[model samples]
Target: MSGIELKQLSEKVFYLPGTVNAAIVLNEEREAILLDTGSDKDHGRRLKKACDNLGVKPVVIVNTHSHADHYGGNDYLTRNFDLPVYAPPLEAGIIQNPVLEPIYLFSGAKPLPELMSKWLLAKPSRVDHILEPGALELFGVALEIIDSSGHAHRHYSVKIADVLVAADAVFGINILQKYPLPFGQDIGGQIASAERMADVGAQVILPGHGEASEDIAGLVKANIAVFEKAAKTIVGACTGVAATTVLKRSCEILGITIKDLPRYYLNHCTVMAYLSYLRESGHVELALQDNELRWSAAGN
Candidate 1:
Protein backbone atom coordinates (compact mmCIF):
# COMPACT_ATOMS: atom_id res chain seq x y z
CA MET A 1 0.00 0.00 0.00
CA SER A 2 1.07 3.61 -0.58
CA GLY A 3 1.53 6.15 2.22
CA ILE A 4 -2.19 6.81 1.89
CA GLU A 5 -4.43 3.73 1.75
CA LEU A 6 -7.14 3.56 -0.86
CA LYS A 7 -10.81 3.78 -0.02
CA GLN A 8 -13.25 1.56 -1.93
CA LEU A 9 -16.42 3.54 -1.47
CA SER A 10 -17.02 7.26 -1.06
CA GLU A 11 -14.69 7.74 1.91
CA LYS A 12 -13.40 5.89 4.97
CA VAL A 13 -14.48 2.49 3.56
CA PHE A 14 -11.98 0.08 2.10
CA TYR A 15 -12.03 -3.45 0.68
CA LEU A 16 -10.09 -6.01 2.70
CA PRO A 17 -9.17 -9.41 1.31
CA GLY A 18 -11.57 -12.31 0.55
CA THR A 19 -15.19 -11.75 1.48
CA VAL A 20 -14.20 -9.16 4.08
CA ASN A 21 -14.61 -5.37 4.05
CA ALA A 22 -14.04 -2.67 6.65
CA ALA A 23 -14.80 0.92 7.54
CA ILE A 24 -12.17 3.36 8.77
CA VAL A 25 -13.21 6.14 11.13
CA LEU A 26 -11.04 8.96 12.41
CA ASN A 27 -10.87 9.25 16.18
CA GLU A 28 -10.50 12.36 18.39
CA GLU A 29 -6.80 12.97 17.50
CA ARG A 30 -7.51 11.41 14.07
CA GLU A 31 -6.49 7.73 14.15
CA ALA A 32 -8.18 5.11 12.01
CA ILE A 33 -10.59 2.47 13.35
CA LEU A 34 -10.57 -0.80 11.35
CA LEU A 35 -13.43 -3.23 10.99
CA ASP A 36 -13.56 -6.90 9.82
CA THR A 37 -10.58 -9.08 9.00
CA GLY A 38 -10.66 -11.21 5.87
CA SER A 39 -10.51 -15.05 5.55
CA ASP A 40 -6.92 -15.61 6.70
CA LYS A 41 -3.83 -14.35 8.49
CA ASP A 42 -2.54 -12.93 5.21
CA HIS A 43 -5.24 -10.29 5.32
CA GLY A 44 -4.17 -9.21 8.79
CA ARG A 45 -0.60 -9.02 7.61
CA ARG A 46 -1.71 -6.90 4.70
CA LEU A 47 -3.68 -4.65 7.00
CA LYS A 48 -0.64 -4.24 9.23
CA LYS A 49 1.49 -3.43 6.22
CA ALA A 50 -1.02 -0.80 5.17
CA CYS A 51 -1.03 0.56 8.72
CA ASP A 52 2.77 0.71 8.78
CA ASN A 53 2.77 2.62 5.52
CA LEU A 54 0.03 4.99 6.63
CA GLY A 55 1.75 6.15 9.87
CA VAL A 56 -1.39 5.75 11.98
CA LYS A 57 -2.79 3.30 14.50
CA PRO A 58 -6.19 1.68 14.15
CA VAL A 59 -8.01 2.36 17.39
CA VAL A 60 -10.60 -0.39 16.98
CA ILE A 61 -11.10 -3.74 15.25
CA VAL A 62 -14.60 -5.08 14.69
CA ASN A 63 -16.07 -8.13 12.98
CA THR A 64 -19.22 -7.93 10.89
CA HIS A 65 -20.06 -11.56 11.70
CA SER A 66 -18.73 -14.87 13.06
CA HIS A 67 -18.51 -16.74 9.74
CA ALA A 68 -15.09 -18.35 9.38
CA ASP A 69 -14.46 -16.71 6.02
CA HIS A 70 -15.49 -13.38 7.45
CA TYR A 71 -13.40 -13.16 10.62
CA GLY A 72 -10.85 -16.00 10.48
CA GLY A 73 -7.90 -13.67 10.83
CA ASN A 74 -8.91 -12.37 14.27
CA ASP A 75 -6.23 -14.50 15.90
CA TYR A 76 -3.50 -12.85 13.86
CA LEU A 77 -5.02 -9.43 14.38
CA THR A 78 -5.44 -9.77 18.16
CA ARG A 79 -1.96 -11.15 18.59
CA ASN A 80 -0.26 -8.38 16.62
CA PHE A 81 -2.34 -5.30 17.45
CA ASP A 82 -3.24 -3.63 20.71
CA LEU A 83 -6.80 -2.86 19.62
CA PRO A 84 -10.02 -4.45 20.82
CA VAL A 85 -12.00 -6.67 18.39
CA TYR A 86 -15.70 -6.00 18.71
CA ALA A 87 -18.35 -8.48 17.55
CA PRO A 88 -22.06 -9.09 18.04
CA PRO A 89 -22.78 -10.63 21.44
CA LEU A 90 -24.71 -13.56 19.95
CA GLU A 91 -21.56 -14.48 18.00
CA ALA A 92 -19.25 -14.58 21.01
CA GLY A 93 -19.66 -18.35 21.47
CA ILE A 94 -18.67 -19.30 17.97
CA ILE A 95 -16.03 -16.58 17.74
CA GLN A 96 -14.50 -17.90 20.92
CA ASN A 97 -14.94 -21.67 20.23
CA PRO A 98 -14.72 -21.68 16.38
CA VAL A 99 -16.45 -25.11 16.18
CA LEU A 100 -19.74 -23.22 15.96
CA GLU A 101 -18.77 -22.01 12.52
CA PRO A 102 -19.98 -25.37 11.28
CA ILE A 103 -20.83 -24.58 7.69
CA TYR A 104 -17.41 -25.82 6.67
CA LEU A 105 -18.34 -29.43 7.48
CA PHE A 106 -21.19 -29.30 5.00
CA SER A 107 -20.16 -26.74 2.37
CA GLY A 108 -18.72 -29.65 0.34
CA ALA A 109 -17.51 -26.76 -1.71
CA LYS A 110 -13.97 -26.57 -0.40
CA PRO A 111 -11.73 -29.54 -1.09
CA LEU A 112 -9.48 -31.02 1.58
CA PRO A 113 -6.66 -28.62 0.74
CA GLU A 114 -9.02 -25.67 0.88
CA LEU A 115 -10.52 -27.06 4.09
CA MET A 116 -7.07 -27.44 5.58
CA SER A 117 -6.22 -23.95 4.47
CA LYS A 118 -9.26 -22.64 6.27
CA TRP A 119 -8.54 -24.81 9.31
CA LEU A 120 -5.01 -23.40 9.49
CA LEU A 121 -6.34 -19.88 9.07
CA ALA A 122 -9.08 -20.34 11.68
CA LYS A 123 -7.32 -20.02 15.04
CA PRO A 124 -9.62 -19.17 17.97
CA SER A 125 -9.53 -15.75 19.64
CA ARG A 126 -11.58 -13.86 22.21
CA VAL A 127 -13.72 -10.82 21.67
CA ASP A 128 -12.41 -7.90 23.67
CA HIS A 129 -15.61 -5.86 23.44
CA ILE A 130 -19.24 -6.71 22.75
CA LEU A 131 -21.42 -5.01 20.13
CA GLU A 132 -25.14 -5.01 19.60
CA PRO A 133 -27.24 -4.06 16.64
CA GLY A 134 -27.46 -0.31 16.97
CA ALA A 135 -25.80 2.90 16.00
CA LEU A 136 -22.19 3.10 17.16
CA GLU A 137 -20.29 6.28 17.88
CA LEU A 138 -16.60 6.42 17.25
CA PHE A 139 -14.07 9.18 16.63
CA GLY A 140 -15.49 10.58 13.40
CA VAL A 141 -17.97 8.07 12.00
CA ALA A 142 -21.55 7.55 13.05
CA LEU A 143 -22.04 3.89 12.14
CA GLU A 144 -25.61 2.73 11.71
CA ILE A 145 -25.33 -0.91 12.73
CA ILE A 146 -28.46 -2.80 11.77
CA ASP A 147 -29.39 -6.25 13.09
CA SER A 148 -29.29 -7.98 9.76
CA SER A 149 -29.50 -11.27 11.65
CA GLY A 150 -30.81 -13.68 9.05
CA HIS A 151 -27.58 -14.76 7.45
CA ALA A 152 -26.61 -15.30 11.05
CA HIS A 153 -28.01 -13.76 14.25
CA ARG A 154 -24.37 -13.13 14.82
CA HIS A 155 -24.31 -10.67 11.93
CA TYR A 156 -24.53 -6.91 11.57
CA SER A 157 -24.23 -4.81 8.44
CA VAL A 158 -22.87 -1.30 8.81
CA LYS A 159 -24.20 1.71 7.02
CA ILE A 160 -22.20 4.85 6.39
CA ALA A 161 -23.04 7.69 4.07
CA ASP A 162 -25.34 6.24 1.36
CA VAL A 163 -23.57 2.87 1.32
CA LEU A 164 -24.82 -0.23 3.15
CA VAL A 165 -22.42 -3.13 3.62
CA ALA A 166 -25.10 -5.77 2.92
CA ALA A 167 -22.80 -8.69 3.96
CA ASP A 168 -24.71 -11.71 2.59
CA ALA A 169 -27.96 -9.97 3.38
CA VAL A 170 -28.44 -10.11 -0.38
CA PHE A 171 -26.18 -11.90 -2.83
CA GLY A 172 -25.99 -13.58 -6.20
CA ILE A 173 -26.97 -17.26 -6.28
CA ASN A 174 -23.70 -18.56 -7.72
CA ILE A 175 -21.65 -15.95 -5.89
CA LEU A 176 -18.40 -17.89 -6.02
CA GLN A 177 -18.46 -18.11 -9.80
CA LYS A 178 -18.81 -14.32 -9.71
CA TYR A 179 -21.95 -14.41 -11.87
CA PRO A 180 -25.71 -14.68 -11.37
CA LEU A 181 -26.39 -11.64 -9.22
CA PRO A 182 -29.66 -12.82 -7.73
CA PHE A 183 -30.10 -12.63 -3.99
CA GLY A 184 -29.04 -16.11 -2.74
CA GLN A 185 -31.01 -16.16 0.48
CA ASP A 186 -34.37 -17.78 1.25
CA ILE A 187 -34.87 -17.65 5.00
CA GLY A 188 -37.10 -15.74 7.41
CA GLY A 189 -34.44 -13.55 9.03
CA GLN A 190 -32.76 -13.04 5.68
CA ILE A 191 -36.06 -11.81 4.26
CA ALA A 192 -36.54 -9.38 7.11
CA SER A 193 -32.98 -8.07 6.82
CA ALA A 194 -33.39 -7.37 3.12
CA GLU A 195 -36.63 -5.57 3.86
CA ARG A 196 -34.80 -3.49 6.45
CA MET A 197 -32.20 -2.57 3.86
CA ALA A 198 -34.93 -1.68 1.42
CA ASP A 199 -36.51 0.54 4.03
CA VAL A 200 -33.15 2.16 4.78
CA GLY A 201 -33.03 3.31 1.15
CA ALA A 202 -29.30 3.17 0.60
CA GLN A 203 -28.11 4.05 -2.87
CA VAL A 204 -25.32 1.47 -2.83
CA ILE A 205 -25.13 -2.09 -1.42
CA LEU A 206 -22.14 -4.31 -0.72
CA PRO A 207 -22.67 -8.07 -0.42
CA GLY A 208 -20.50 -10.41 1.67
CA HIS A 209 -19.12 -11.85 -1.56
CA GLY A 210 -18.93 -10.55 -5.13
CA GLU A 211 -19.37 -6.97 -6.40
CA ALA A 212 -21.18 -4.01 -4.97
CA SER A 213 -24.19 -2.41 -6.59
CA GLU A 214 -26.10 0.84 -6.81
CA ASP A 215 -29.86 0.83 -6.26
CA ILE A 216 -30.84 -2.75 -5.38
CA ALA A 217 -33.76 -2.25 -3.01
CA GLY A 218 -36.28 -3.72 -5.41
CA LEU A 219 -34.14 -6.81 -5.97
CA VAL A 220 -33.77 -7.37 -2.26
CA LYS A 221 -37.52 -7.28 -1.79
CA ALA A 222 -38.00 -9.65 -4.69
CA ASN A 223 -35.58 -12.10 -3.14
CA ILE A 224 -37.52 -11.95 0.09
CA ALA A 225 -40.63 -12.98 -1.78
CA VAL A 226 -38.69 -15.88 -3.21
CA PHE A 227 -37.84 -17.00 0.31
CA GLU A 228 -41.45 -16.91 1.48
CA LYS A 229 -42.75 -18.75 -1.54
CA ALA A 230 -39.99 -21.32 -1.34
CA ALA A 231 -40.58 -21.80 2.33
CA LYS A 232 -44.25 -22.40 1.77
CA THR A 233 -43.55 -24.82 -1.01
CA ILE A 234 -40.97 -26.69 1.06
CA VAL A 235 -43.27 -26.90 4.04
CA GLY A 236 -46.14 -28.07 1.86
CA ALA A 237 -44.07 -30.78 0.28
CA CYS A 238 -42.89 -31.99 3.64
CA THR A 239 -46.50 -32.81 4.52
CA GLY A 240 -46.76 -35.45 1.79
CA VAL A 241 -43.30 -36.63 0.82
CA ALA A 242 -40.11 -38.03 2.28
CA ALA A 243 -37.03 -35.87 2.83
CA THR A 244 -35.26 -37.55 -0.05
CA THR A 245 -38.21 -36.95 -2.31
CA VAL A 246 -38.27 -33.31 -1.25
CA LEU A 247 -34.57 -33.03 -1.87
CA LYS A 248 -34.92 -34.59 -5.28
CA ARG A 249 -37.74 -32.25 -6.16
CA SER A 250 -35.79 -29.26 -4.90
CA CYS A 251 -32.81 -30.32 -6.97
CA GLU A 252 -34.98 -30.56 -10.07
CA ILE A 253 -36.53 -27.21 -9.38
CA LEU A 254 -33.14 -25.61 -8.82
CA GLY A 255 -31.83 -27.20 -12.06
CA ILE A 256 -28.89 -29.24 -10.82
CA THR A 257 -28.07 -32.87 -10.24
CA ILE A 258 -27.01 -34.05 -6.79
CA LYS A 259 -23.84 -35.53 -8.25
CA ASP A 260 -22.97 -32.22 -9.84
CA LEU A 261 -23.31 -30.31 -6.58
CA PRO A 262 -20.83 -30.18 -3.72
CA ARG A 263 -20.05 -33.78 -2.74
CA TYR A 264 -20.95 -33.41 0.94
CA TYR A 265 -24.65 -32.74 0.25
CA LEU A 266 -24.14 -29.06 1.03
CA ASN A 267 -27.27 -28.39 -0.92
CA HIS A 268 -29.12 -30.96 1.15
CA CYS A 269 -27.63 -29.77 4.44
CA THR A 270 -28.69 -26.21 3.72
CA VAL A 271 -32.29 -27.27 3.27
CA MET A 272 -32.14 -29.56 6.29
CA ALA A 273 -30.88 -26.73 8.46
CA TYR A 274 -33.38 -24.30 7.01
CA LEU A 275 -36.16 -26.78 7.71
CA SER A 276 -34.82 -27.34 11.19
CA TYR A 277 -34.84 -23.62 11.83
CA LEU A 278 -38.35 -23.30 10.46
CA ARG A 279 -39.55 -26.25 12.52
CA GLU A 280 -37.99 -24.82 15.66
CA SER A 281 -39.60 -21.47 14.90
CA GLY A 282 -43.05 -23.11 14.62
CA HIS A 283 -43.26 -22.25 10.96
CA VAL A 284 -42.96 -25.91 9.95
CA GLU A 285 -43.50 -29.30 11.53
CA LEU A 286 -41.76 -32.59 10.82
CA ALA A 287 -42.27 -36.27 11.66
CA LEU A 288 -40.39 -39.40 10.88
CA GLN A 289 -42.72 -41.93 9.30
CA ASP A 290 -41.95 -44.98 7.13
CA ASN A 291 -38.27 -44.42 7.86
CA GLU A 292 -38.27 -41.02 6.10
CA LEU A 293 -38.52 -37.49 7.39
CA ARG A 294 -41.75 -35.81 6.51
CA TRP A 295 -42.75 -32.16 6.97
CA SER A 296 -45.64 -29.77 6.73
CA ALA A 297 -46.47 -26.22 7.69
CA ALA A 298 -47.95 -26.07 11.17
CA GLY A 299 -51.72 -26.73 11.25
CA ASN A 300 -51.70 -27.75 7.63
Candidate 2:
Protein backbone atom coordinates (compact mmCIF):
# COMPACT_ATOMS: atom_id res chain seq x y z
CA MET A 1 0.00 0.00 0.00
CA SER A 2 2.83 2.38 -0.80
CA GLY A 3 0.71 4.86 -2.70
CA ILE A 4 -2.67 3.67 -1.46
CA GLU A 5 -3.07 5.48 1.83
CA LEU A 6 -6.34 5.72 3.71
CA LYS A 7 -7.49 9.31 3.39
CA GLN A 8 -9.37 10.60 6.41
CA LEU A 9 -12.83 12.01 5.81
CA SER A 10 -13.89 12.61 9.44
CA GLU A 11 -12.82 11.72 12.96
CA LYS A 12 -14.02 8.15 12.38
CA VAL A 13 -14.18 7.81 8.57
CA PHE A 14 -11.40 7.02 6.09
CA TYR A 15 -11.40 5.79 2.48
CA LEU A 16 -9.09 4.23 -0.06
CA PRO A 17 -9.67 5.79 -3.44
CA GLY A 18 -9.35 3.91 -6.69
CA THR A 19 -11.71 3.00 -9.53
CA VAL A 20 -14.19 2.48 -6.68
CA ASN A 21 -13.91 4.19 -3.32
CA ALA A 22 -13.81 1.70 -0.39
CA ALA A 23 -14.62 3.45 2.88
CA ILE A 24 -13.37 2.51 6.33
CA VAL A 25 -15.32 3.59 9.38
CA LEU A 26 -13.95 3.02 12.86
CA ASN A 27 -16.17 2.06 15.76
CA GLU A 28 -15.58 2.90 19.41
CA GLU A 29 -13.54 -0.29 19.77
CA ARG A 30 -11.45 0.63 16.69
CA GLU A 31 -12.93 -2.15 14.55
CA ALA A 32 -13.37 -1.09 10.92
CA ILE A 33 -16.54 -1.53 8.85
CA LEU A 34 -15.75 -1.41 5.14
CA LEU A 35 -18.25 0.19 2.75
CA ASP A 36 -17.97 -1.39 -0.72
CA THR A 37 -14.76 -3.17 -1.67
CA GLY A 38 -13.16 -2.20 -5.00
CA SER A 39 -13.16 -4.16 -8.26
CA ASP A 40 -11.08 -7.28 -7.35
CA LYS A 41 -8.76 -9.09 -4.92
CA ASP A 42 -5.89 -6.69 -5.48
CA HIS A 43 -8.11 -3.90 -4.21
CA GLY A 44 -9.01 -6.04 -1.18
CA ARG A 45 -5.35 -6.73 -0.38
CA ARG A 46 -4.47 -3.08 -0.79
CA LEU A 47 -7.32 -2.04 1.42
CA LYS A 48 -6.19 -4.54 4.08
CA LYS A 49 -2.69 -3.17 3.95
CA ALA A 50 -4.04 0.35 4.28
CA CYS A 51 -5.97 -0.77 7.35
CA ASP A 52 -2.81 -2.29 8.86
CA ASN A 53 -1.07 1.00 8.31
CA LEU A 54 -3.90 2.82 10.07
CA GLY A 55 -3.79 0.30 12.97
CA VAL A 56 -7.41 -0.84 12.67
CA LYS A 57 -8.94 -4.26 12.00
CA PRO A 58 -11.72 -4.62 9.41
CA VAL A 59 -14.46 -6.56 11.19
CA VAL A 60 -17.33 -6.08 8.75
CA ILE A 61 -18.17 -5.22 5.12
CA VAL A 62 -21.30 -3.43 3.87
CA ASN A 63 -21.88 -3.65 0.14
CA THR A 64 -24.24 -1.00 -1.25
CA HIS A 65 -25.22 -3.19 -4.20
CA SER A 66 -24.41 -6.28 -6.27
CA HIS A 67 -22.43 -4.68 -9.08
CA ALA A 68 -19.17 -6.50 -9.77
CA ASP A 69 -16.97 -3.44 -9.27
CA HIS A 70 -18.59 -2.63 -5.94
CA TYR A 71 -18.55 -6.11 -4.35
CA GLY A 72 -15.74 -7.72 -6.28
CA GLY A 73 -13.31 -7.59 -3.37
CA ASN A 74 -15.68 -9.28 -0.91
CA ASP A 75 -14.34 -12.75 -1.60
CA TYR A 76 -10.79 -11.70 -0.77
CA LEU A 77 -11.65 -9.88 2.44
CA THR A 78 -14.08 -12.57 3.62
CA ARG A 79 -11.48 -15.27 3.06
CA ASN A 80 -8.76 -13.36 4.91
CA PHE A 81 -10.87 -12.27 7.87
CA ASP A 82 -14.08 -13.46 9.49
CA LEU A 83 -16.00 -10.45 8.29
CA PRO A 84 -19.77 -10.46 8.07
CA VAL A 85 -21.07 -9.24 4.70
CA TYR A 86 -24.22 -7.10 4.64
CA ALA A 87 -26.16 -6.19 1.50
CA PRO A 88 -29.69 -5.34 0.42
CA PRO A 89 -32.03 -8.37 0.17
CA LEU A 90 -32.32 -8.68 -3.62
CA GLU A 91 -28.74 -7.62 -4.25
CA ALA A 92 -27.37 -10.26 -1.88
CA GLY A 93 -28.70 -13.00 -4.12
CA ILE A 94 -26.66 -11.74 -7.06
CA ILE A 95 -23.63 -11.09 -4.86
CA GLN A 96 -23.65 -14.80 -4.02
CA ASN A 97 -24.32 -15.80 -7.64
CA PRO A 98 -22.50 -13.25 -9.78
CA VAL A 99 -23.17 -14.94 -13.09
CA LEU A 100 -26.65 -13.50 -12.79
CA GLU A 101 -25.16 -10.15 -13.74
CA PRO A 102 -24.14 -11.03 -17.31
CA ILE A 103 -27.16 -13.33 -17.60
CA TYR A 104 -29.56 -10.50 -16.92
CA LEU A 105 -27.49 -8.10 -18.98
CA PHE A 106 -27.84 -10.45 -21.94
CA SER A 107 -31.62 -10.26 -21.58
CA GLY A 108 -31.80 -13.53 -19.54
CA ALA A 109 -30.06 -15.61 -22.16
CA LYS A 110 -26.73 -17.36 -21.66
CA PRO A 111 -24.14 -14.58 -21.88
CA LEU A 112 -21.53 -14.58 -24.58
CA PRO A 113 -17.85 -15.07 -23.60
CA GLU A 114 -17.19 -11.34 -23.85
CA LEU A 115 -19.72 -10.65 -21.11
CA MET A 116 -17.97 -12.95 -18.60
CA SER A 117 -15.10 -10.61 -17.79
CA LYS A 118 -14.37 -9.35 -14.27
CA TRP A 119 -16.10 -6.07 -15.07
CA LEU A 120 -19.42 -7.96 -14.98
CA LEU A 121 -18.62 -11.13 -13.02
CA ALA A 122 -16.91 -11.39 -9.65
CA LYS A 123 -16.01 -14.34 -7.49
CA PRO A 124 -18.94 -15.43 -5.33
CA SER A 125 -18.85 -14.48 -1.64
CA ARG A 126 -21.16 -15.27 1.23
CA VAL A 127 -23.59 -12.67 2.51
CA ASP A 128 -24.12 -13.23 6.23
CA HIS A 129 -26.57 -10.37 6.78
CA ILE A 130 -29.34 -8.67 4.82
CA LEU A 131 -29.78 -4.89 5.02
CA GLU A 132 -32.99 -2.92 4.83
CA PRO A 133 -33.51 0.80 4.45
CA GLY A 134 -33.40 2.27 7.96
CA ALA A 135 -31.12 2.85 10.90
CA LEU A 136 -28.45 0.19 11.46
CA GLU A 137 -26.02 -0.22 14.31
CA LEU A 138 -22.87 -2.24 13.81
CA PHE A 139 -19.68 -2.48 15.87
CA GLY A 140 -20.98 0.38 18.06
CA VAL A 141 -21.24 2.78 15.13
CA ALA A 142 -24.60 4.23 14.08
CA LEU A 143 -25.47 4.05 10.37
CA GLU A 144 -28.51 5.08 8.36
CA ILE A 145 -29.21 2.96 5.29
CA ILE A 146 -31.18 4.76 2.58
CA ASP A 147 -32.94 2.81 -0.16
CA SER A 148 -31.40 4.04 -3.43
CA SER A 149 -32.41 1.26 -5.75
CA GLY A 150 -32.48 1.72 -9.57
CA HIS A 151 -28.79 1.61 -10.38
CA ALA A 152 -29.01 -1.97 -9.27
CA HIS A 153 -32.17 -3.32 -7.73
CA ARG A 154 -32.20 -2.64 -3.97
CA HIS A 155 -29.00 -0.56 -3.77
CA TYR A 156 -28.53 1.13 -0.39
CA SER A 157 -26.58 4.20 0.66
CA VAL A 158 -25.00 4.59 4.09
CA LYS A 159 -24.88 7.66 6.30
CA ILE A 160 -22.33 7.99 9.12
CA ALA A 161 -22.31 11.29 10.93
CA ASP A 162 -22.37 14.10 8.32
CA VAL A 163 -20.77 11.89 5.69
CA LEU A 164 -23.05 10.00 3.31
CA VAL A 165 -21.72 7.05 1.33
CA ALA A 166 -24.09 7.73 -1.54
CA ALA A 167 -22.97 4.62 -3.47
CA ASP A 168 -24.13 4.76 -7.09
CA ALA A 169 -27.22 6.65 -6.08
CA VAL A 170 -25.50 9.74 -7.44
CA PHE A 171 -22.41 9.70 -9.57
CA GLY A 172 -19.57 12.18 -9.27
CA ILE A 173 -19.27 14.95 -11.85
CA ASN A 174 -16.39 13.12 -13.53
CA ILE A 175 -18.37 9.87 -13.69
CA LEU A 176 -21.33 11.70 -15.20
CA GLN A 177 -19.00 13.08 -17.86
CA LYS A 178 -17.36 9.70 -18.47
CA TYR A 179 -20.53 7.74 -19.15
CA PRO A 180 -23.26 10.07 -20.36
CA LEU A 181 -26.10 7.64 -19.67
CA PRO A 182 -24.25 5.92 -16.77
CA PHE A 183 -26.05 2.68 -15.77
CA GLY A 184 -29.54 2.17 -14.48
CA GLN A 185 -31.66 -0.96 -14.21
CA ASP A 186 -34.69 1.19 -13.44
CA ILE A 187 -34.60 4.66 -14.91
CA GLY A 188 -37.65 5.91 -13.02
CA GLY A 189 -36.25 4.75 -9.71
CA GLN A 190 -32.88 6.20 -10.62
CA ILE A 191 -34.37 9.63 -11.26
CA ALA A 192 -36.37 9.48 -8.04
CA SER A 193 -33.34 8.41 -6.01
CA ALA A 194 -31.27 11.25 -7.44
CA GLU A 195 -33.96 13.69 -6.41
CA ARG A 196 -34.12 12.17 -2.92
CA MET A 197 -30.38 12.49 -2.35
CA ALA A 198 -30.67 16.27 -2.29
CA ASP A 199 -32.78 16.05 0.87
CA VAL A 200 -30.69 13.36 2.60
CA GLY A 201 -29.20 16.15 4.85
CA ALA A 202 -25.58 15.09 4.51
CA GLN A 203 -23.08 17.95 4.46
CA VAL A 204 -20.46 15.78 2.75
CA ILE A 205 -21.12 13.09 0.18
CA LEU A 206 -18.81 10.27 -0.94
CA PRO A 207 -19.65 8.59 -4.21
CA GLY A 208 -18.73 4.94 -4.82
CA HIS A 209 -16.39 6.35 -7.45
CA GLY A 210 -14.65 9.72 -7.93
CA GLU A 211 -13.86 12.35 -5.32
CA ALA A 212 -15.92 13.23 -2.26
CA SER A 213 -17.57 16.63 -2.15
CA GLU A 214 -19.73 18.94 -0.04
CA ASP A 215 -21.91 19.99 -2.98
CA ILE A 216 -24.59 17.35 -2.54
CA ALA A 217 -27.23 19.49 -4.19
CA GLY A 218 -25.09 20.12 -7.23
CA LEU A 219 -24.29 16.43 -7.56
CA VAL A 220 -27.92 15.47 -7.32
CA LYS A 221 -28.89 18.00 -9.97
CA ALA A 222 -26.17 16.80 -12.35
CA ASN A 223 -27.23 13.17 -11.98
CA ILE A 224 -30.87 13.97 -12.66
CA ALA A 225 -29.90 15.95 -15.72
CA VAL A 226 -28.00 12.97 -17.12
CA PHE A 227 -30.98 10.67 -16.53
CA GLU A 228 -33.42 13.09 -18.12
CA LYS A 229 -31.13 13.74 -21.05
CA ALA A 230 -30.85 10.03 -21.70
CA ALA A 231 -34.60 9.64 -21.37
CA LYS A 232 -35.22 12.44 -23.89
CA THR A 233 -32.71 10.99 -26.33
CA ILE A 234 -34.22 7.51 -26.10
CA VAL A 235 -37.71 8.88 -26.49
CA GLY A 236 -36.73 10.74 -29.61
CA ALA A 237 -35.08 7.63 -31.02
CA CYS A 238 -38.25 5.55 -30.58
CA THR A 239 -40.01 6.84 -33.71
CA GLY A 240 -41.38 3.51 -34.80
CA VAL A 241 -37.93 1.99 -34.51
CA ALA A 242 -36.87 -1.42 -33.22
CA ALA A 243 -35.01 -1.61 -29.90
CA THR A 244 -31.63 -2.12 -31.57
CA THR A 245 -32.26 0.77 -33.92
CA VAL A 246 -33.29 2.96 -31.05
CA LEU A 247 -30.16 2.07 -29.10
CA LYS A 248 -27.99 2.79 -32.12
CA ARG A 249 -29.59 6.12 -32.90
CA SER A 250 -29.49 7.21 -29.29
CA CYS A 251 -25.80 6.26 -28.96
CA GLU A 252 -24.94 8.00 -32.17
CA ILE A 253 -26.68 11.16 -31.08
CA LEU A 254 -24.91 11.06 -27.71
CA GLY A 255 -21.45 10.41 -29.28
CA ILE A 256 -21.21 7.06 -27.45
CA THR A 257 -19.51 4.17 -29.19
CA ILE A 258 -20.15 0.56 -28.25
CA LYS A 259 -17.25 -1.45 -29.57
CA ASP A 260 -17.56 -4.48 -27.26
CA LEU A 261 -20.29 -6.74 -26.02
CA PRO A 262 -19.92 -5.49 -22.45
CA ARG A 263 -20.35 -1.85 -23.40
CA TYR A 264 -23.04 -2.68 -25.92
CA TYR A 265 -25.09 -4.75 -23.46
CA LEU A 266 -24.67 -2.28 -20.62
CA ASN A 267 -25.95 0.51 -22.83
CA HIS A 268 -28.60 -1.78 -24.31
CA CYS A 269 -29.95 -2.68 -20.89
CA THR A 270 -29.94 0.98 -19.82
CA VAL A 271 -31.72 2.05 -23.01
CA MET A 272 -34.29 -0.67 -22.44
CA ALA A 273 -34.82 0.66 -18.92
CA TYR A 274 -35.41 4.11 -20.35
CA LEU A 275 -37.97 2.73 -22.80
CA SER A 276 -39.76 0.94 -19.99
CA TYR A 277 -39.87 4.14 -17.99
CA LEU A 278 -41.15 6.23 -20.89
CA ARG A 279 -43.80 3.65 -21.78
CA GLU A 280 -44.97 3.45 -18.19
CA SER A 281 -45.17 7.23 -18.06
CA GLY A 282 -47.32 7.24 -21.22
CA HIS A 283 -44.72 9.22 -23.14
CA VAL A 284 -44.16 6.34 -25.54
CA GLU A 285 -45.94 3.26 -26.82
CA LEU A 286 -44.92 -0.11 -28.23
CA ALA A 287 -46.48 -2.28 -30.94
CA LEU A 288 -45.81 -5.71 -32.42
CA GLN A 289 -46.12 -5.79 -36.18
CA ASP A 290 -44.97 -8.69 -38.36
CA ASN A 291 -43.01 -10.22 -35.46
CA GLU A 292 -40.94 -7.04 -35.09
CA LEU A 293 -41.53 -4.90 -32.03
CA ARG A 294 -41.63 -1.18 -32.82
CA TRP A 295 -41.67 1.84 -30.54
CA SER A 296 -43.03 5.34 -31.08
CA ALA A 297 -44.21 8.33 -29.16
CA ALA A 298 -47.54 7.63 -27.52
CA GLY A 299 -50.68 8.32 -29.60
CA ASN A 300 -48.58 8.79 -32.70
lDDT of 1 by residue, 90-170 (tens): 777778877544444444343344334463236777888788777888666788888887766657888876878777676
Task: Assess candidate 2 and give its TM-score to the true structure.
Answer: 0.98
* Per-model TM values vs. the true structure: 0.77, 0.98
CA shift of 140, model 2, Å: 0.2
List where candidate 2 sits over 4 angstroms from the true fold.
Answer: 1-4
Kindly list the per-residue Cα lDDT of model 2 for residues 1-300, writing each as its tens digit. Answer: 332577778889888988899899999886899999988999999888888887789999999999999999999999989799999998999999999999999989999999999999999989999998899999999999999999987989999988999889889999999889898999889889888887888888988878888999999998888898898999889899899999999999988988898999999999999999999999999999999999998888
Model 1 misplacement above 4 A:
1-7, 22-30, 51-56, 103-121, 172-186, 225-239, 242-245, 256-266, 276-285, 296-300
Best-matching candidate per lDDT: 2
Give per-model CA RMSD.
4.7, 1.4
Candidate 2: lDDT of 51?
Answer: 83
The residue-level lDDT of candidate 1 at 239 comes to 60
